[model samples]
Target chain A: MAKGPNVNWLPVKDDNRPVNLDLTKFHFPLPAITSILHRISGVLIFVGTAVLMWLLAESLSSEEGFQRVGEWLQSPIVKFIVWGILSGLLYHLIAGLRHLLMDAGIGETLEGGRRGAVLIIVFSVISILIAGVWVW
Target chain B: MVSRVSGATNLGRNGLHDWVLQRFSAIVLAIYTLGLLGWFAVNPDFSYGAWRGLFDATWMKIATLAAIIALCAHAWIGMWTIATDYLTSLALGKAATFVRLLFQAGCVILIFTYLVWGVQILWGL
Candidate 1:
């Protein structure tokens, strides 16, 4: 919270005129931030899918290939990228669950939704940290 | 409001259909992910032999195939939703529709390739 971006994405006055609408000057609410983060994590995992597919295909190709994959996991940079993708997957999974819950009529209120968003942040950080440990 | 101009191009030509498919595919994907995590936990130091054995099973192959299909469907809907949400006339001006369709066509081809490639990888196992 020390240094934050400065922008209001879609601020409008009572008359529906633009208040700021500057991308950099956006003031993000917790809910909005969480929602955007969900979108971001989904896109990240989507882009990383090709790498994942390649890894799967290679690892299953032969004994030598499988051993190579295991060894690749030992590399620090490979481990980092794996962890990043895992983090994105886990975040998307968690946020997607929240969306499902909302669709099912749970936490549908403004206040309840805020609480859900807060819970998502807490859970995602803890889960991502745990996944990091597991990956490394 | 979300745009409906591109609705006809959506999967099944129905928002509810896309919505249901998205959620269904999501559940399948989540289950598949959790299943992998469970396998990892059980294997601890899973060797190449053990890993191959896991996928070599008929059940596991079926599960993997199902997961890949769900992944493609889930991704298609998600990408389409993102495009319609942002790649619009309101944001991208007059050429938005053209640009969006081009982007979407790319997505479709990529997803289809993933689907075919995934099936090949799995069944060839």
Candidate 2:
């Protein structure tokens, strides 16, 4: 029989003491950063979906409704908002695909996960730039 | 030494289901988004007629409805996870958890309303 490494098992201690820690001083790794941004992007997309649904409903209602949405899209502020929404969508989509790939066991290793995160950021930035040009 | 309980309840048993649904919805939304963007790119002059014509197709209407449903599912799970993970507060007792549940429920109602409204708009009914 093959020998295995020894393990140490410790008994649990009852401790309800409060521990103060500063989150601002913490350093986030690439994968952690990507994961947090994915959550943030999901929230952004959720809010943006509301706005998009409203626009779709308005545009599909009648000719006047369509014209109203068309006119609204012509404003610079509206365009900016659209750009922001698109950027969020792009990043979310890319990072989300990475997550899916990870789920499929493609990037399960630490090194692979880091590389995937970097690729997500790079690709998303390029896509967002393209979306900005298209929107404006 | 503290006594350890072997049969402690698992908090994350249902999380796996939500995780799978989120990923599934994400795939659907991604395809719909890319397809919509491609349609827009190919047809630069997006007039009212063009918009109406696109949605008038039965297939397009069905796809759009599916996408909307997927979006709702995806958003609900995402928001629910975020709320549960970040809304805990020791000082506020269970207030944070209560508020988180309320917000999630509100979001579900809003999303369902939008989904119904979107379908009506798509079919012009």
TM-score of chain B of each: 0.92, 0.82
| DockQ result, candidate 2 | 0.47
Write candidate 1's Cα lDDT for B12-97 as tens digits. 55888999999999999999998998888788888888988998998998999999899989988988888888886657777778
Fnat score for model 2: 0.76
TM-score of chain A of each: 0.84, 0.82
- For candidate 2, give the lDDT of residue B23: 78
Query: What TM-score against the true fold does each predicted structure earn?
Result: 0.89, 0.84
lDDT tens string, model 2, A1-136? 3332221122333433443333455688988888899899888878887788888888887889999988998999999988998999999999988888888899899899889989998999999999999987
Candidate 1: where are CA atoms >4 Å away? A1-25, B1-5
User: Where does model 2 sit among the CAPRI classes?
Assistant: acceptable
Error of 1 at B100 (Å): 1.0
Error of 2 at A115 (Å): 1.2
* Candidate lDDT values, in order: 0.85, 0.78
Residue A122, model 2: lDDT of 94
lDDT, candidate 2, B8-114, per-residue tens: 11122366876777778888999999999999999996888889888999999999998988888787777766766665443234465567667777887887887
- In the range A13-43, model 1's lDDT, one tens digit per residue, is 2343334544567788899999998888888
